[model samples]
Target: MASVKTTTLPGGIINRPGSTIDYKTGTWRVKRPVVNLDKCIGCLICWIYCPEPAIIKRDDGKIDFDYDYCKGCGICSLECPTKAIRIVEE
Candidate 1:
């Protein structure tokens, strides 16, 4: 039998909030998502679908992108029912 070591606090666990913000991951993005305000229904689907959570929901119910953290994954565009979000080359 082999011995295994474990701890109450696991490694690679995010213990603090907003730690990802310190890293700007969008530097390598070749494409980015753009939101059409006129077509946007403010449904928040994009915000919920974004893997990086780069979508920002404003106080007015509208949404915006945090390009600094957005990796251009296009998950938001695929999830948007209104098709308000579009991916474009950078």
Candidate 2:
């Protein structure tokens, strides 16, 4: 097996009436992965397998991910043990 890596920087103009936040990753908004913190156990499994390393653990022990860098591949949602994540078509 081989590994594929991707990196992207966020770009956009300030609030100017409907200015689009340009995310270079082509799959932007392709799928929406919602994390259910209510069910999340802070296991960090989703964080480890996230190909883009988008998941970030806050100092308060909450988890969040950067959507701008997410490819929406659904791997994280699938790998979550507690069913803490789900992917919806966008």
Candidate 3:
């Protein structure tokens, strides 16, 4: 298993409500997920499997990732049925 890097608040504790909004976690990524729209069949598997709530349904009936909140965990790539998502080194 791979280790995950994360942000810790000062004193390793969060004091504010909704503190997650203050963090842009994508900076911690060593690898990033990329979407291949050509292979994407509009399946919602990636959205469903993404633990970060990063994958979102778009108005065009396609899906997009909110990279600011994404930790590059690669679950979306693994779950994509058509192999539409790939993980690449940053």
lDDT top scorer: 1
lDDT of 2 by residue, 1-90 (tens): 012224323563343543233444525558868888898888888889988777888776757878767778887889999998988887
Q: After superposition, which runs of candidate 3 have C-alpha atoms over 4 Å from their true positions?
A: 1-16
Q: Which ten residues in a row have the lowest lDDT in candidate 1?
A: 1-10
Better of 1 and 2 by TM-score: 1
Measured against the true structure, the TM-scores of the candidates, in listed sequence, are 0.76, 0.66, 0.76
Question: Candidate 1, residues 1-90: lDDT per residue as tens digits?
Answer: 012124435665767676556668887688999999888889998888888879999888888999988999999999999899999999
lDDT of each: 0.84, 0.73, 0.80
Give me the runs in candidate 2 sitting further than 4 Å from their true place.
1-23, 26-29
Q: What is the lDDT of residue 5 in candidate 1?
A: 21
Q: How well does model 3 score by local distance difference test?
A: 0.80
Error of 3 at 78 (Å): 0.8
